[model samples]
Target: MGERLFLGVDGGQSHTEAVVADERGRIRGRGRGGPANHAEQPGGRERLARAVGESVGAALREAGLATEVSEVEFDAAHCAMTGGADFKEEVIRSIVRARRLSIGHDAPAALAGATGGEPGIVVIAGTGSVAYGENGLDRSAQAGGWGYLLGDEGSGYWIAMEGLRCALRAVDGVGDSTELGTRALRHFDLKDFRELARAVYAGRIDRDRLATFAIEVERAAREGDASARRIIAEAAMWLCRLVIAVAKRLSVESVKVAAVGGAFRSLSLREEFAQRVAQHLPLARVIAPRFDPAVGALLLAYGAAGVDLTEEILSNLEKESGR
Candidate 1:
């Protein structure tokens, strides 16, 4: 084997992550770049190519240096993106030359990263939200990934919007004055709604900025704000429902679930999600992910190369990640 290189890329709404690893699953380099929501983005073809190039190129360079090689050859490339189904393969094929290139949705990438390619479920809540599940038989199902307008009930965007909605309600005298309002004010660093309305009407703030306020909602909830607590609880409930829906679709009595993405980083939210899911579906087990989504994409590459993620190899990967 002449330095077999496998590339895995996770193209997400917020950012793209790429990892370069050897055939043995030893991670050599990791890199990040811009969003790769290719299907919906204007100039999506070029944008997707640029983001994937930047991230994967950086990782490839790092790996090359580690192995004392001036250039590295890619044997396989596996990519998972938010709008992966619609991603034009030519965009990827134009950038990197590999013997084989595989592409799919980001959800399964998250699930594989969370469950180490085992049969399980992965729920993502970041700029967007989605739920993906795979049973032991390799059968799969998904729920709650209909974009922001239709659903995404438990996603970071939803929580941020809820925070803003509640604040607007308070301002309009329809809801109680709670810390959510204060938190929103502080999040934007504005003194009053006049500044907020002016900025919004002027198109000064965008949807991404709105989603950034979700941290404030979590913070206010931590400080015992009732409205904030309720918002977070509702988010948790929505997320839990995704798990139940997937389980029912899979027709499995029990399945391990992995909570992935920035949303589950909150302990309170994570614990609350577990509690709520158990109330309805006792077999839904929520566990921390073994690796990040990009790495999950890398593992998928390993599978394509006929490499099994054996316990020993998994252990080595864990040690490489220092987790």
Candidate 2:
């Protein structure tokens, strides 16, 4: 007889977020926790479980619903994770109970959030990069998202790795000499290339840690470093290719494209991406996201539970969540 409660979660390489909402589509609470990317890695399942428990538990408490994540029962729930859903579903089921559940990769959730479930494409550049689009006809397509080893061309990790490579090349006196070398040494708190190499080879600098340097690269570009500017331009070009590929595959003359994630935090990058999309696809428009991926998962939860969300309800969600 209590009010119907819904749940949404966005699990990414950098962090995990949980949102609690009421039947009227107003955000009740929000919570955050550490990363939950690869469930097949060592202790991945346990890490995923703990992340879910922590984020959900915090959200439930904030909503004044339950003290523990296990104590709360949801009418419906949706989870969108960086890694695929197959392995995560089992781990999630062991932690929380929901009458209806939907689980998938983060791309669709991001698209839903970007366009509010309408037909559109979303280009996400976080620790990794991917582009996904829907045609509103149950047809969808994706580009990139190959991860760090093979792809992730426009991602934060990629940008940072490129910066490091440029710096190393400068050290060898074979590449463009720029501020990246001095900046990287200061950023990593190392005295020289030998120390930097030692930290990297010893696994002291992991993928996420390296990705944090992308922001510094952006700083270098803003400060008028030619090599850094080229890196940014190239990253923008690669990301635009993703958008164009999705648009062509969907065969849509016009579509809204939204950029999401940490890499877009740089105004320079966002402007570059928007400009590239405009040049390549004149009909395509780059728009700001109406909601973050977590709320997009909540929207999917509402759909799965047969809840018809009105504009008023969505407005409440937007206003209350401050999105």
Please count the clashing residue pairs in each candidate, in the order shown. Answer: 0, 0
Residue 136 error, candidate 1, Å: 1.8
Clashes of 1: 0
- Candidate 1 per-residue lDDT, tens place, 54-124, comes to 88877866765433222455788789988654546877777766777888889988888888889898889
Query: In lDDT terms, which candidate is top?
Result: 2
Once fitted onto the true fold, the runs of candidate 1 whose alpha carbons sit more than 4 angstroms away are 65-71, 85-87, 201-203
Compute each candidate's TM-score over C-alphas: 0.94, 0.98
Candidate 2: tens digits of C-alpha lDDT, residues 64-137: 88998878789999999897747788899988799997788899989888887688999999999999999989
lDDT on C-alpha atoms for all candidate structures: 0.82, 0.91
TM-score, predicted candidate 2 vs. hidden true structure: 0.98
In candidate 2, what residue range of length 10 has the lowest lDDT sum?
Answer: 81-90
- Which stretches of model 2 miss by more than 4 angstroms? none
